[model samples]
Target: MRKTIIGLDLDRESSQISYYSERSMEPETVSIQENQDRYLIPTPSDLFTLIEGKVELGQMTLANFLKTCIGYIGPSVKPENVCIMITMKEITLAWADALRNACQMIGIPGEAVFLQTHRESFCCYTLNQKKELWIHRVALFEYEDTKISSYIMDIDYHTKPALVRAETGKSINLGRQGARSQEQWNEQRDARFLEMIEEVFQNDTFSAVFLIGDSFDKTWAVESLQYLWSNRRRRVYQGRNLYTKGACYAAMQRMDIGKRLDDFLYQSEDLVEHNLSMQMEHRGKQSTHMLINAGTNWFEAEYTCEFILDDTDEVVIYARSMMGGEAESYSIVLKNLPERPKRTTRLQMRLKFISQGRCKVTIRDLGFGEFYPASGKVWESVLEV
Candidate 1:
């Protein structure tokens, strides 16, 4: 039997789940209601708020909730063969850890659980569609709780491994805060939505547009709906399962189950854009050694190395952009060091990212096996990429 690949759209308010269907070969959204199209399962109001205080309790609650969700998949499914991708509006290192802990409590391996942002989920969903649907720019409009948001995605084929970028755009409060009547609010909403569409679509050609939300319909968006479907002449679809389906696709992509997106790379906000390396003597020859690699999450990117100082009191790290550019070197000076023979001073270097464009570097002096004696000294610096 094949492994069970799953995508879960987890949020504070509600959650949705999708699973890759072996028979249909597509992600099918799980409906909470037996004979309805409902996909949302109400989440606990205090689930996220309590994570800041009682961490263990929060993780337990999350694990129990996830266990309930997994029960809906099937009785024959095994936890060892499940791969789950969790996508949210935004993910911090703390939340990522909590989610992974929850999965671990439920017998899921750490390697089988993944986390991503909604923007990446959007890219996965769009790129997985037919080529014609995403050959050009793709637009997405999401309406929720009287608010509307817009996002645009572009692909740069000029780059090797085609870069896919999705950015959040305009947002507006379309709720009936001070409404005269339903009809008046609908009319005003239609006009405002049309203006927003014009602002985004002007002087740009989009191959497809997606509307994500539960409340979107033709009743209030008659003019805007007609404009998007007819004037733009692009494929328009409305649904609430895009993110979950995209999460499923992300899992599939990570597991090498699909080749549709093998040539594309999605650079999300948390990804590192530069490669960190240094020159070191290895096996009697000088070579460039990688310290931290590009395309790694900032929170998880860290490296440690031990080296002998050849003839300098300074440690240098080279940063090279992934987009093809000259490597820039940043140096950290070792201060108040004990006089030692050449190549006799052993040092330990540690590098870690604080954010996308910033990193922290520390070097500690470790005397060469009692020959030079220990100085117990440490040097710290920050590198801006």
Candidate 2:
């Protein structure tokens, strides 16, 4: 059976769902109505409440919302064959856990679910496009509610695998609640948007510009649109489903279902910048064994394993940047360990990130089975990555 890749874009205002399979050439946004372009699904207020760390009594709003969104994918795609990537405006540790739990409640396995920020979603979408589109800098303007924010993505070709980073630019609120007439509001918004566009476009050579949100259209953004299209080389598009499609691409890349995106690495704000590893003897050969890899969300990076101490009283860990540089070594001296035969003391080590720049490692003495009883002692240390 062919696996199904699903991307669900979740936000406080609205959400979008898109899917891809072996048959489809590209990811298609799932609309509530068949044969229609209506893709935005209004998110329930209760879901937002839950995302804000407040869960009302007996309310399963998030699970219900997820079920409703995934229902549009049809019955042909089974839960087991589906891999989902959820993109949102902002993500926290609690929010990520809530989304995973919601997917779990809806019959989706936790490992089958993935989460990313909207910034990374934009990067994913851009990277999946033609080379010319993202070879230079790419610009994105997202108008949400009463504010418009700009994001610029650039690729550093100097890096071996190349580094893709998106920077958040200027943002301004286009207040129209007090406008007396639609014409006045449109004119004022166009002028302000034009100014913002000019300011951003002047700094870099953008190959493509994407306009997102329900409020952006030719009618209200006449002047800004004209200015953006002034450069014949720059391509412009308007859509609200970019995040959903980007999520789909992410899922596709993860499952290696279609196109493989192994060249460029997205360096998002929440990414763990260093790889945590240790030099150990594996199968009687000494080599560096990686415990945690870089380019993963700090909150989600963790590793645990058991190893026997071999003629060493100190544990050395190496942290290296993803951009390819010398590895920095950190050591923890086990001064209180019981003096036993070399390579006889068994130890269990666990590593977890406290933040993007900090990691906490805990090691416990397990002793050697019945010969040397457990010491019931633990050593902990925090490393600055």
Candidate 3:
């Protein structure tokens, strides 16, 4: 089945989410004449204004825009059939909650939300056989909850080239210094990282893995996988491998969760059954009836049981003597007693019984246990028929 994929990028100031049908073409920018004065690179403030009232406009705000843009931009294609890009910088918990709610509201469903954190990395290449300029890009490091030591390294790749130039006025070779140094860091903490990745592989049913973000760091993630099983001599499965060849935002736009997202949202039958059992136990406890006034305080002596039967016929009284008092006594009486005196039925009846010091009384019917005040209060029926 075609999956509905939604990519969420949580930023410091504003958040961005990209939603598209799995079968539809990737969303692209269209040159609209409405605002030709606006720059190609839309400012964060402008994007914020556009998205504000537009959220209430429903998926049409995105779907209509994408349809219009794609129509205008013409038939643009990619090397890979899947992936969509989104850019945003909001990082508040409120935004996170809103994004989650919005996805549900849009009928996107839970299975389609593919969440990833972005990291910055660099790539050096010759543009048109001219000068070699370092391309600053964002890389996505897979968020493995089990990986304790692996840090999401978001190095400002743009600043790194300048810093390298300032430190050494000659050509700065990152492959020798930076990349090698990173490999060393990985060597020290590689085992723990593998354990984390392994835990995720075991726990989650992810069909395809999209290594989105910096193109250069993608190599590091792939290389690190080798280091993991090399020491242990275990083979890593390579069925689904997706490499995003663009910035974090660009890569997010092209990502697809496919059917995996759907599986993530729905619980297994076993889990549902277990939850149902727990609910039944909770409901049973709440519905079970118990006489609250039957129990007495800890300071009382021996208690009495007197059932005042009105016109209602045949009331079987079951009484139990509370254990663990000054007098260690516990009794269970299951007997049908005679009806009380005519006028005396309306008055409170005090059973003429006395003990040593303090005790408690427990009374029960067809339902559950009920404790009453042993000495302070007596059972009285105000109903006279």
- State TM-scores per candidate: 0.82, 0.86, 0.24
The lDDT of model 2 is 0.86
> Model 2 reaches what TM-score against the true structure?
0.86
lDDT of 2 by residue, 41-154 (tens): 999966776667556521368888888888888977677777999998878766766777777877787678888888988999998899889878999999988999989999
1-385 per-residue lDDT for model 1 (tens digits)? 5789999998778899999888888888988877898889787777888665656789988888888777677777777788999998877666776887899999988888888888889999999899889988999999988889988999999888998999888888886748468789888899999999999888899999999997787888999999998845589999988999999999998788764776898877789999999998889989999999999767657788898998888988999997788999998999987788899999999987767788989889999996887789999998999
Reference-based lDDT, residue 236, model 1 = 95
Residue 378 lDDT, candidate 3, scale 0-100: 29
Per-residue CA lDDT of model 3 for 60-96, tens digit only, reads 3443433332233224422123233322322222333
**Model 3 residue 136 CA deviation in Å:** 36
lDDT of each candidate versus the true structure? 0.86, 0.86, 0.28
Rank by TM-score, descending?
2, 1, 3
Off by over 4 Å in 1: 33-35, 52-56, 177-179, 278-284, 299-317, 329-352, 360-383
Clash statistics: count for each candidate:
0, 0, 32
Which pairs clash in the backbone of model 2? Answer: none
